[model samples]
Target: MKAIREARGISLRRLAKDIGRDPGFLSRVEDDKQGAGPGTLHLYASYLDVPLAAITHKEIPRDQERPGSPHGDDADPPPDGDQGSC
Candidate 1:
């Protein structure tokens, strides 16, 4: 994500503000330290003009967290063998 964003000459601050997110939050998303919510990912896809999947290949499946459902940021991390990490 960072690579693509940088390649497109978009600054993290600019993209974060445009997509209504904090730059630190976007940084974590790029680094895979946090899982982005679906809505947040959609905003990124729209702002970056890229396919959603391109940025969400490792996102939690919608079936696991229905759209609009809340995800606790501090929830227990996925198991070591789980499909969580990108």
Candidate 2:
């Protein structure tokens, strides 16, 4: 999500302002530290000009993974250099 947003030249501040959310909260969501509800997901999809399925599909598969599994999608954090500063 963060990658797509950055690629589209959308800033965290601007996205939050447009979606009526706090930048910090949205940042957490982007970092996968928080889970976005359906409403929030819809807002993001609408603002980003993406289909809701694009976002929901990624989330659904992750949620179905067994807890404490040794292997799972995104079980590892991205490399430090890959993250852009907000």
Candidate 3:
């Protein structure tokens, strides 16, 4: 998590503000002392310019060249054929 934040040049305070959370709380989450709920993780991913799956499912192997891979050029689309923009 810290790596992801640093990769995007985001500070803890700024990320907390963007996600409507407290810096200390965010810190705990990053330190793995506390867990962020799915909703909070989603917000963090959005604010940090990361994919939700990256944080939520860390064990999953990513194939960057695949269309839906987080590291790929294509942004993931919603299921159910929805065309929602990220």
Query: Which ranges in model 2 have alpha carbons more than 4 Å from their true place?
Result: 57-86
The residue-by-residue lDDT of candidate 1 on 1-86, one tens digit each, is 76557656899999998888999999998999998888999899888777887677655433334333345344566667788556
lDDT of 3 by residue, 9-29 (tens): 789998888789999998998
RMSD of each: 13.1, 11.6, 13.2
How big is the RMSD of model 1? 13.1
Give the per-residue Cα lDDT of candidate 2 at 43: 97
Q: How many clashes (backbone atoms < 3 Å, residues ≥3 apart in a chain or on different chains) does model 3 have?
A: 0
Ranking by lDDT: 2, 1, 3
**Colliding pairs, model 1:** none
lDDT per residue for candidate 2 within 1-86, as digits (tens), equals: 77567756889999999999899999998888998898888999899887777565544334334444345654667778899978
Query: How far off is residue 77 in model 2, in Å?
Result: 26
lDDT of all predictions: 0.76, 0.76, 0.73
